[model samples]
Target: MKDSNFLKENNARHMWHPMAHPADSLANPPKIVVGGDGVSIRDIDGKEVLDAVGGLWNVNLGFSCEPIKQAIAAQLDALPYYSTFRGTSNDQVIELSWMLREFFEPDGLTRAFFTSGGSDSVETALRLARQYHKVRGESGRTKYLSLKKGYHGTHFGGASVNGNANFRTQYEPLLPGCFHIPAPYTYRNPFNETDPEKLAQLCATALEDEIAFQGAGTIAAFIMEPVLGAGGVIPPHASFMPMVREICDRNGILLIADEVITAFGRTGDWSGSRHWGVKPDMMSTAKAITNGYFPFGAVMLNDKIADVFEQDTSGRGAIGHGYTYSGHPVGAAAAIACLKETQRLDVAANAGARGAELFAGLNGLAEKHDLIGDVRGGHGLMCALELVSDRAAKTPIDKATIGKIYEATYEAGVMVRVSGPNIIMSPPLILTVEDVQKIVDALDAGFSAA
Candidate 1:
């Protein structure tokens, strides 16, 4: 193992991290996480803190998941890697596909098209969506619609549909014909409505309006996150997704639920689409699919979408998009084990129970801390506290203040993600009630310092 000094130097000098300024590494060095146990991670300085970010919203089973680890090791020894492209298919991936089919069967997703990660999953889904339309003789349907604050992924296709300016601004001119509608955000919205149901109706109306303006025949699909994870853990009303589903059904537009962060019990359900009782035509999943042990993902397709390709005699029906590491054996093995443990433990139930406690605790913090402008979550393990300098004006908290809070919270024994003015938390599903209290208590310490 390299010493701390060497590690720190290389971290600043050689590596560039995602979603961070390259210069920031030298100015404010990134913490070097050396080891993890259960849900707590030990940094290079041997300081341990409960990880509230959950390895970028993927590590649902946490760092020390033995089953996934063993599966990876065993698969490596047997068959380290193999492609799922064309004729060649390995045993692990085959078994994994069968498991996935059964696992996501309730969501009306019967087919699995594997990918390397979230971005790839989304990219594949988008291409397939366009192709699906073309195969169905609707070659003109190439446009996409999504929530204004929703996040898909980093790929050009995903970024085009991505609603956040932070992810889109510098990358434009993105794919043409991609549009966004107002998200069902209760705290701050263009509509100024606070009621969840009402906001949902307005948001759905916005989607309808966009479709009408774009001409429904031109839109291929409406893609969205089930709970809106990266754009700040914004969980929509119960009726929101169902409304969108109905809208899509009526327009003959595919509803592609981007479940990268909300799948595998992150939203207190096996899959986020199932949470709202709406079945999407296609769904993109990753993150917890292998419990973050492997960089793997799958784009799930329903019978409606699959039938178009399966029964197509024309060459256009044949799928053209795929990743080289689509169904890597090692990743497949990890996913297989993860699916077993994920179901056996029924982590969704724990996520729901613990989430209620965390949400209540955060609300308590909101009452005490003037910095917290809004507290969002009641959905599951997904939660966020949007901070503000002044509650009345809802002015976003400064970076320095957020940094202070982050340092203080780490000192108080918790590791939370500070995304702009939002303190986002998507902790492990296995986290207990006691763990929930520690996170809240640590955040309280953070706020108290301010």
Candidate 2:
């Protein structure tokens, strides 16, 4: 490794980070992570801390997931690269599809469309949703509906469906016909509803209103995260998703569960849709699919989608979209190994247990510090603390204030992600009880310093 100053100079000179200003690189150089093991990571300066961000909400199995690492190396040695395109499918992908079908059998997902990552998965699902409608002779159903504060991805389709303006404003003139409804965010809402269940009902009604206003016949699908992730880890009421499912069913609109952050047991269940007891027409999964060992994703489809495409005599059913690395053998091998390890460890159970403890700790911190305006968690390892300048007015905390808390937290011995005014934590599911307490203590320290 190069010296700190050398590495820093080169990074600032060459690197352009995503979701950040290029100029910010020179002023506020990003932390250089040089090593990771177990659930901890060490920066270039050799400052080690418990990782609560979980590698961008992936890496559920932590850094020492040997099975996935070994599988990737073995597959690279056997077949470095093979594209599953145009009548040529790799053995690893084929086996992985079968495993995925069985694993998601409960969610009614019978088919798998592989992608390179979360963005690819979201793009694939959006395209498939429109195609599914077209296959059934409803090509007019091209519009998509989503929840406010929802995040899909960066692709045209995903970006259009994204409800957050941060990802959309700069990239204007995105794909047309994408609509959004109010999310069930109980903390602050236009409806001013504080009760979660009531807010969910109101939000569901907003969906119905949007369907009515847009004419459901023209809407192709509704995409949403079971627990809104990047827009902030906002978990809706227990009744929210099921209500959305029923509404979509009635409107004949496909529901695409964007499980990019909630799949493979991050939400205290095998999948978020399962946690809600509602099966979506299609599900976009990635991140933990390979435990972040490899860039991989899979969009799982139910029989309703599969039957339409399979039964179509016309070539309209033919998928017009795919990635060159759609079914890369290396990615497939890693996913297979990850699935085995994820199931063996039963990560959902650990996520549930640790998640509860973490949520409680955050709430306790809220009591101690006025900085924490809202504490959101409960489903699993995904959690967040929405900070504020004024608790009474709910004024968003300034950037420097949140940055202070972020730096203090890191200094106190935990690395968390700060987005806008929210401190998000999607730690590895393998977190120990002691690790959970440490995270809490670190945050306490962060707040005290702030």
Candidate 3:
């Protein structure tokens, strides 16, 4: 039996991949990654490919960091798992919480609740937002508002709160009271302009209109990513977040910053809020927390909301929520290691520099490729290339053409991500200038072929 066929057969028999059709995967089997080191992954066929997406926008410290591996191993040897439920705790979990607080350092960030990953983290934030209002005697505030094209997570609450229609259409009847408004997408602004500040104010005005339409009293919180991640790598318009912050404050609504893909070093800052100069009442984070070495996520809350829980909860009710692995010791240990590495290596600084290089490189690609409609990115090792059949009208490539570009790029040995008709490049924070150039070259070649 052929070696490739043997592995493919095994996968066909039992494996089901996410975001992919089983039949399609079987016909063109998934690339079986066997190992990783630095910013590269090795397929089972021994082909080395640059990991441009950081394993779904995690892995900030990149493929194999000795410290993270050692930390996890040490934790496994000492205490593999421990629950943060019912008042029991572990040293790693406790320390990691404080560490995150230090990293964020925003006013009112006083508590941390851990989850296994991003979806759970989103759920945690959603629940906390609803409960905060309830505890404050504003139980009428049950509505959540997110931005257009935003992605929170895959859970029912998150899916409902999310504004991307494609992710929510098939699973309708999602949690009621979720709403959406226009995002600060300057490239394709509803009102056309290149001025970031003007675009920002316009977007904020749209949000205000939405709130007026729904009655702001019914809104619990407005959730968004400071720098859009999976949706399109779109950054917030200039001063957009500051204006949004004021809007939330004025309406007495919580601001939930979903930094699942932008936390840690991704955005050249510990949190995307800091990167964008916005202050969130609470933040949802995962992906980079453990640097993709382990699965972990967390909801960091400010003092304002934690105070509500402190008062008179003894008789009214328990908080009534927590995952079994809420604060897993192993995940905590890995996160601690990852944080230490981030500080020691200054990965955020690296990302700041690399992001500039990457953006310039992709923009350079735009000058060469007429198929490239737009290139968007900033200090986050994040980028998006919107493909277009007509540059002036900004008409997107047909789905078939996009699939061909995606497959061509993958076959050319660069693993990236695609959203809608746009290609996303989120190279890990550890990438070097040369690594970034390789990615740009591959994308250039792929676009040329497609």
Write down the TM-score of every candidate: 0.99, 0.99, 0.96
Q: After superposing candidate 3 on the true structure, give the runs of residues whose Cα lies further than 4 Å from its correct spot.
A: 1-3
RMSD for each of the candidates: 0.8, 0.8, 1.9
List, in order, the clash count of every candidate structure. Answer: 0, 0, 2
Location of the lowest summed lDDT over 10 successive residues in candidate 1: 8-17
Q: List the global CA lDDT of all models.
A: 0.93, 0.94, 0.86
Q: Name the runs in model 2 displaced over 4 angstroms.
A: none
Q: What TM-score would candidate 3 get against the native?
A: 0.96
Candidate 1 lDDT score at position 400: 96
Local lDDT at 187 for model 2: 93
lDDT pick, better of 2 and 3: 2
Judged by whole-model lDDT over C-alpha atoms, candidate 2 comes out at: 0.94
